[model samples]
Structures are given as C-alpha cells and as structure tokens.
Target: MKLKFGFEEFILVFSISMFFFGYMRIKFTFMVIKVTDYYLYSYGNKGLLYCSLGLIALFTYFIIKYISKNVNTTR
Candidate 1:
C-alpha cells in the first residue's frame, strides 16, 4: 500500500539525512588524518574536529528520535 507524509515530516527527514551525511564525511576526514603518515600532529585541529563530531552526533540522534516520535506515520 502507498503511504503519504506531511510536509513537516518531509523536512524533518531531510534535515536528519543531511546531518547524518555530514557526520559520515567528518568521520572519514578524521580517519584519513589519523592514517596519513609524515604529517605533523595537528593538535588544535584534531581537538576541534573531535568536539564538532561529538556535538553533531548528539544533535543528529536527538533530531531523528524527536522527528520520528512526533511525526505520526500511522495512516
């Protein structure tokens, strides 16, 4: 059976997907930095990157959970 969704739900889903995409990209970047050799340790950049990833991860979790709970998909 086909299903329909409200505009608000669509926007929320879009936002959650975007956040997840960002988180994945950042994770990849960090992995590359850690694996690459011969480069000097960038402490400041590493610290900020870790902090930002944590913050974004937390936000993404909350956003998806809240959006899913709030959007009634039972049609």
Candidate 2:
C-alpha cells in the first residue's frame, strides 16, 4: 500500500493530538488537586478546573465540527 497525506490526514492527526492533550491536561489537573488539596482552597483550583474543562469542551466541539464538515468518505 502507498502512503497518502492530505488535509483530511492533517485534521485527523490534529484532532487525535488535541484529544490526547486535553485528556492529559484533565488528568494532570486532577493530580494537582489531589496533591494540593489543602492549599488549593485559596488558590482557586476550582476556577482552574472549570476553565480547563471549558477549553476542552470547546476543542472537542471544534474538532467534531471540522471532521463532520470535511468528511467525504462514502465507505
């Protein structure tokens, strides 16, 4: 089989990377919460969590929309 690279491939790679990055960010955020549960009370960790979650949601939405808009495969 031959290799082919194009816009669809680029979007696929980008979306996958974004998903992994978002997952890591969420995991790391929870780790931080666990590690700093005491001090996090004054440091607005909740705000950080909410912001990160919003960003992740937006990224997911954009990726889904892009994939749906660009998808041309019939099989």
Winner by TM-score: 2
* Weakest ten-residue segment in model 1 by summed lDDT: 36-45
* Best of the candidates, lDDT: 2
lDDT of 2 by residue, 36-56 (tens): 565655445554555565566
Model 2 misplaced stretches (Cα beyond 4 Å) = 34-75
Per residue, candidate 1 scores C-alpha lDDT tens digits across 1-75 of 667787655655665665566556556566675554534235435545555665565666678767888786753
Give residue 27's lDDT in candidate 1 (0 to 100): 62
The residue ranges of model 1 lying beyond 4 angstroms of the native Cα positions read 1-3, 34-75
User: Local error of candidate 2 at 51, Å?
Assistant: 12
